[model samples]
Target: MDNDPQAQTLIARFNKMKEKYEEVERFGRYHPDYSTIMKEVRVSKREMDMHETIAAYKIKETELQSFLDEISQIVAYSVSDKIMVPMDGALFKDGGCGCGSGGGCGCQAS
Candidate 1:
């Protein structure tokens, strides 16, 4: 979120960790501050991923991707009579829902 202060803070903190890691990355496996900074960077990344807005966005993004994939299959089925359809059948497959729209069709393909 462009205007989200908390997200901005986390991003800045993560960037700082990146810079610190760069300073110590040349050291071998036992670099003390490198591990600490890397751990902090990972934690910061997880925090961003778990943020409420970001988490919701990711869920919706996944659903949208599924819908898009279903549509792509549906389009191919329309042109191929199922010949070009992937083995991973969607509702567009025969005896399936025949509708890619997630409209609570109550069909098993859903």
Candidate 2:
């Protein structure tokens, strides 16, 4: 909702991907030769691999978007004080440095 250009771009991309998926679904459902076309398609190994890669990326993009949406909701709730626990310091024990027993870089739990 903010005037962030990156967010706007991501939203646009997501919308375009959704439209493309709908179009593909419609085509597969209505086209008489849809199965035949898929069976007869003669793609090289590289092309097939790229297609798989693109599909995987599309799925990951959707998952990442969902995660971001969840995170945004959590942040909104936190800002509104709907969440009781303070997320910042609630992860550690005794408010001490979070270094583990090894105590190297304070990156681990003690």
Candidate 3:
């Protein structure tokens, strides 16, 4: 992507959101206090959603809708496949790794 200041700023915001979302997801997975941790996760998800909406608005206003839309689709597909689907499977199944990495460090196995 070009080094446009607005695009750079919006990309930084999205990166921050992705990091925060991953942190909350990790906490929700491994925290000892499940109930409290999930509450925090829910709050964080809502905040991320609000930020995404605002970012969409900013992109639209600046005529960066196509750029943002393409990036958003990639991010959404990745998050859905890597995080959401695995989380749902873990909740429903026996909580095994779905990536088939054979218990490697990729799955954070000790």
Candidate 4:
């Protein structure tokens, strides 16, 4: 998507419309151009989201985020103390990420 002309065009259009929307918003709801600019913003956003490559990328991004969140809960990767929290029951019983050597943060459970 980095070098795709269509993606770049769509992104530029969306960003331009978004900036316009923000500018109009500061002028309050009574601004005459507010409605028109808002519509443009919505259209550009929808156009970008409906693009095949962008849509697929977004879906994969969401899936990866969900997987990361689940991992964070099941392991101690996101914890301050590196203590693994039991998901359903428990993941590590050795305590403190279960990294037996105390080598680093996070669990080493295989």
lDDT against the true structure, each candidate: 0.70, 0.51, 0.54, 0.76
RMSD of each: 9.7, 14.1, 13.9, 11.1
Tell me the TM-score of each prediction against the true structure.
Answer: 0.53, 0.29, 0.27, 0.67
- Highest-scoring model, lDDT: 4
Tens-place lDDT per residue, model 3, 39-81, is 6556655554456555566557656644565566578787774
- Candidate achieving higher lDDT, 1 or 3: 1
Candidate 2 runs further than 4 Å off: 1-50, 81-110
Indicate the worst ten consecutive residues by lDDT in candidate 2: 40-49
- Between candidates 2 and 4, the one scoring higher on lDDT is 4
Across residues 17-99, which tens digit of lDDT does each residue of candidate 4 receive? 98888889999689899889988989999999999888888889877866775787766755565674444323443444456
Pairs clashing within candidate 2: none
For model 4, what is the C-alpha lDDT against the true structure?
Answer: 0.76
